[model samples]
Target: MVDTALFTIRDERLSLILTRRKDPPFEGLLALPGGFVHAQEDADAEAAVRRVIRGKIGFDAPYLEQLYTFSGAARDPRGWSVSVVYYALVPWPLLEKNTSVELCPADELPALPFDHHQIVAKAVERLRGKATYSSLPAFLLPGEFTMNDLHRIYQQTIGARLDKASFRHKILEQDIIEEIPSRFRTGAHRPAQLYRLSSKTLTAFERKI
Candidate 1:
């Protein structure tokens, strides 16, 4: 089985982790980070996906979800194969500090081996679509932030501008975040209220998906 991993980087750019293939079928070309599931070592598809990610990228994602599965005889050169795909989100700040792996922009990628490009495109689409009603975009931000910070992340993820007042109203009504009482000091202005995800689990903010 095959597996893929995605992470968001600075400036709200979504990137996919890719490594050069050194084996047969397609050698010396960049492709999604993946490996065959070792039946003996893995208890399930999810476990194998996690193992592939940890071994390749060396970091556990704050949020990880199964994107889709692709299967067919022609998909792989070595007989028939099935691929379980997953997309993960990590704060941009965390991505900048990690240097273990290379991240390629999902939308502006080079020629990829096999059907990896298709997998990246599908993952990107799902992330943007779900950002509208879910808390998925919060994974791109820091733990403590102001309303403006949260709003900007959402707007960037969805690729649309939102009215400041309206967006604030919706966020407050949803009760997805809670105020920290303490304020974040900004230069030459009153302190801004700090906010964070009310629930510790990233996906627990909303269950719309």
Candidate 2:
């Protein structure tokens, strides 16, 4: 089995997708998007997961990373089962575009089937653990946004408010984001400049950002 813990931001809140299962073993209950491996059609594990997510959600996430492996004799009712889990960061706009799925608050997920509750908890842990020192939260935003916008999402991801000056200083010092040539308008206020991730991958610093 392959399951994807896909997360997105809405109204400055971090949330993950959960679909109601219509099949046996947990019909009518909420669960993560997943399915069995298509060994004959998929070339590899990553491809299998990509297929599972796309088939289930009708959208592809930008950042897909392996979370962990879950296997046990009784984890699933169908004999001994193994599930390869992946965690992803999806752009909020894309999530908005896809209306078939439901976004559950990452911290307040309801009861889930099998080991899905554990899977979501781990995915949240991974996101929050790397949020402070990396550019992981940027994937939750659009291609262009303001420093204040970035700060708000980061605070939502980490569940802690950050000082404006301190947050701006850390982001600029690391140089992970580049300011755009254009500015965004806020009603009755000065136009704020937009920024986006400066590179393809996030770089780790000697000290946490």
Residue 132 displacement (Å), model 2:
1.3
Model 1, residue 77: distance off in Å is 1.8
Q: How does model 1 fare in lDDT?
A: 0.77
Per-residue lDDT of model 1, residues 1-209, tens digit only? 75766666555666666777888878988887788789999998878878887777677777888999999888888778889888877776766655656677767888988888788888888888888887788877778988988888888777778899988887887788898875674767777888888875644334332
- TM-score (C-alpha, index-matched) for candidate 1: 0.87
Write down the TM-score of every candidate. Answer: 0.87, 0.94
Task: Give the alpha carbon lDDT tens digit for every residue of 1-209 in model 2.
Answer: 79889888876678888788989998998889888888799887789989978876676677788999999987888788888899988877876666678888887888889989889889889888888788888888878888988899889988888898989998899888997776664767888888878986756655655
Model 1: how far residue 21 lies from native, Å = 2.9
Q: Scored by CA lDDT, what does every candidate get? A: 0.77, 0.84
Which prediction has the highest lDDT against the true structure? 2
